[model samples]
Target chain A: MIEQSINKEPIIATDNNGIVIDIRGLYKSFGAHNDVLKGVNITVNKGENLVVLGKSGSGKSVTIKCVVGLVAADKGEIKVFGTDITELDDKQLNAIRIRIGFLFQNAALYDSMTVRQNLAFPLKRHSKSLSPKQEEDAIKEALDNVGLAEAIDKMPAELSGGMRKRIGLARTLILKPEIILYDEPTTGLDTITSREISELILAIQKKNKTSSIIITHDMACAKLTADRIVILKDGIIEAEGSYEELEKSDNDWVRSFFI
Target chain B: MVISLKNIFNDAGNVTQFTARFFKEVLKPPYEIKEFIRQCYVIGYRSLPLVGITGFIMGLVLTLQSRPTLAEFGAESWLPGMVALSLIREIAPVITALICAGKISSGIGAELGSMKVTEQIDAMEVSAIDPYKYLVITRILATTLMVPLLVVFADGVGVLGGYAGININSDVNLLNYFSKVLESLDFIDIIPATIKTFFFGFFIGMIGCYKGYTAASGTESVGKAANSAVVAASLTIFVIDMLAVQLTDIFF
Candidate 1:
C-alpha cells in the first residue's frame, strides 16, 4: 500500500541493498512471426518481493523463463547479482542457477521420488560438504519449515494441492537460494489455502532474506504479497507500481481490477 | 500446396529452436551423472529382455525361411554364415534401435510432455534447478551408453538362435555351424555395426527428449510429443543406417 512516484529511469545501484536482478531491453519470440515478449526492462532489489500480474499468455512466464535461461531471449541483457546472465556460458549459468530457487506452479515434484528424496536432490547436487547425516538433518529442517515434516516419506500424488506446494517450497529452500521465483503459487488453491501460501511465501522471504518475483493473475495475491507490482499485457508492461499506486491509476485496465 | 509448405517450414523452425536449446543446456555443468545412470538402467537394462527375445525370434525365423532357398542352390551349409553376417551386420543393431526408439523415446517424450503440460518444468526453473541438465542429459547419456550394450547382447543371442535352427532342422553339426558363423564374422563387421548404434541411441534420446521438453501447451501436446518421439527416432535411425552403409561400403 506504499505510494511512490513511478519513473522509467533505472533505480540507482547501491551496495547496502544490492540490485539482485537487472533485466534490460529483453526480447523473445517463438519464431519469425510469433513474438511473446517485446522489449521489457525491470530491476529487482535484494530481499524485495516483486509480483508480476498479467493475464494468461501475456509473457509473464516467458519473462522469468528468460531470466533463468530456460527460454533463451533473442536479444537484451539479463544481469543477476552483477553478472550478465545473457553473456554467461552454460557452466556460468548453472553456477548462478544453484544460487536461485524456483517453485513451479504445479509443484513439479518428481513423481518417481518420495518427498525425502526430492528434498535431498538439490542438496546432493549443490552441497559438497554436507555429510549424509547433515543432509538428512537439513531435509528435516526444510520440511519442518514448510510444516510438512510428517509428509517426508510420502509421494507428491498422496498430498493435497496445498501440501504439494509446501513440498515444492521445501525443495526450493533446500538449495538456500539467494533469489526465489514463484509461478502462480496460489492459482488452483481455495481462498484459505491461497492466503496461507502467501503468508508462507512472506515468511520465507523474511527469514531467508531472499528476493522474489511471483507471476500470478490473482490481484488479491499481488496485493497481499508484493511490495511492487508490474502488470504485463500483450507482451509489454502496462503498469508498474506499488499495489496502492496501481489501484489509483486512471488506466481502465488497471482500475478495472480495483473497482 | 502453399499451406503445406508453410506448415513444413514452421515445423522446421520449431525443431531448430529445440535443437539449439538442447545443445545449449547439455554442455552446462552440475551434470546429472547419477540420474543419467539410473535412466540408463531404465532405458537400457530394463529393455534388454524384450530386445533379446525379438532378436532371437528374428534370427530363428529368418534362418528357417532361408533354408529352402539355400537348399535349392545345393548350398545349405552357407546358411550359417549368411544368417550370422546379416544378424550381426544389420538385423540386431537396427531392430534394437527401433525397439529402443519405441520404448525409451516414447516414455521420455510422454513423461516430459506431461511435466510441461502440468507446469512442473516451469516450477523447476523457478526453483533455480536447470531442468534441462537434470532431465535431458541424464536421458541422452542413458541412451548413448545403453543402446550399444543392447545391440551387443542382441547380436550374440541372435547368432545362437540361428545355430539352434541349423542344428534342429538340418544335419549341420552344431560345432561346425558355430565355427563357420564365427569364422565368417570379424571385428570389422561387428564393430562398425555396433558403433552405429551409439548414433542411433543419440538420435532417439535427443529427438525424444527434445520433443517432450519443448512440448506445446496442454494435454494434447503431451501425446504429440510421445508420438513424434517415436516417429522422429525411427526415421533418424533408418537415415543414419543408410548413410552408414554407404560410407562403410566406400571405405572398406
Candidate 2:
C-alpha cells in the first residue's frame, strides 16, 4: 500500500512508467454504519483496460466515482497525471475531469434533448471556439464512431437500451478524453447487445488509445476487454491478476466467480 | 418524531444554502441565456391558459358571492371597486402564485428529480458544466420574471370576469365598470402586490429546485421531491403573502 502523501505534492514516478491514475489508501463511508470502501488502492496505466469485479454493495462504483471526484473520499491520495487530485478545488478538479470521461450504468442521456443536441451539449460548453459546422461535424463523427450516425436527430427516449449505451459512449468520446471510466457498460443489455457493447469497448480502446476502468459483473466483458482485473471483497481489493490466472486460483471465493 | 423534526431543520438549512449558491452562480459569467429563454417559454407562456381560467373563475365567484352582502347593505353600487381592490391587492397575487407553485414548482421538481435519478445531472457535472448554474439558476430566474407577469395577467382577467358577473344582476357598461375598477386601484395596491409575487416566484423556484437537486437516490424520491415541492412552495407563498400584507399595512 502506498503511503498517503502528507504534503499533497505531485508524485513523479521515477521510471516515467505510464501510470495515469494512482490511488492510495482511499476510505469512504456512508452514514455511520456503512463503511463502503476501506483502504482501497488502485492504479490504471496508460492505454490499459482495468476491469473492477465486485459483488453488489462492494463499492466498485464508489471507487471510480472517487477517482473522478464525483464522490469525495474520506482519506486518500488520488494522483491523476502525477497531480494529487484530492487536494484540487472545483475549478482545478474540473480541469482534470475534462480529460476523463465517465459512462454511467444507465447511459445518463439527457432525455429532454435529441441525440444531436445531447452530443452538442458538452461540446458547446467546453469548446466555445468551435464553429457551428465544426460542432456539427464533431457530433456526426462521434455518432459515426459509435455506429449510430443515422440516429442523430432522434430523442434519447426513441433509442433502444444498447443504442443508448452506444450513444452514451459517443458523448463520452466527444471531447476526446484520454481515460474513460465505464460503470457496468453492459448491465441491462441482452446477450447479443452485451457482446456488441463489450466489443465496442475493445474497439474504442484500440481506436482512441484510451485507458479505462470498467466496473462490471459481466465476466465475458471482462475477458474480452480487460488487460487486468481486480476483484473487491470486504471493501478492499482481495485479488488482482489477469483473467485466466485468477480463473484457476486456489481461493474458492475468487474461483467461485468464474464458475 | 424527534428524527423527523431534525430532518425538517436539516432540510431548511440545506434549502437556504442552496438558495445562497443560486445567488452566487446567477451573477457569474457563461450565463445560460438560451436555456433561460426556453424555461421562460415553458414556465410562463405554457402556463397562461390554466392561469387565465383560474383567474376568471376566482373573479366571477367573488363577485357573485359578495352580491347578496352588498345588496343587504344597500351598497350594490360599490361592488366593482370592492371586487377590483380585493383582486388586485390580495387575491390575484396570492392565488396566481399558489397556482404557479402547484404547476411550475412541481413540474421543475419532477423534471429535475428525474434527471437526478437517471444521473443526467452527474453527466452534466462530469462534462465540466455546472448543473446548478445551467439547470437551477435558469429555472429560478425564469420563474422570478414570469410569475409576476402571470399575476398581472390574472388581475386583468379577473377584473374582466368581475365585469361579466356584474352584468348578470344589472346593466353596467364595459367602459363604466372598468372605470370604477380602475378608480379603486392605486400605486400602493399594485406595487406591493406585484413585489410580493416576485418573492412568491423566487420561493417557488428555489424550493422546487432545492427539493429536486437534493433528492435521495431512488426512483421513489422523484415522486417525493415533486410532491414535497408543491407542499413547500404553497406553504411558502402563504407565509410570504402574510409578511407582505403586514409590511404593506405598516408602511402604507
Q: Please give the RMSD to the true structure for each candidate, in Å.
A: 6.1, 4.6
**DockQ per candidate, 2 decimals:** 0.42, 0.89
**Model 1: CAPRI class:** acceptable
How accurate locally, in lDDT, is each candidate?
0.84, 0.91
Fnat for each model: 0.56, 0.91
Clashing pairs in 2: none
What are the runs in model 2 whose C-alpha is more than 4 Å off? A1-16
Clashes of 1: 5
lDDT by residue for model 1 over A132-241, one digit each (tens)? 88888889999999999999999989999999999999988877777898889998999999998999999999998999999987777878889999988888889999
Candidate 1, residues B130-154, lDDT tens digits: the string is 7877888789878988999998899
Ten-residue segment with the worst summed lDDT in candidate 2 chain A?
Answer: A1-10
Instruction: Mark the regions of model 1 whose C-alpha exceeds 4 Å error after superposition.
Output: A1-46, A69-96, A228-230, A233-253, B1-31, B116-134, B166-177
Write down the TM-score for model 2. Answer: 0.96
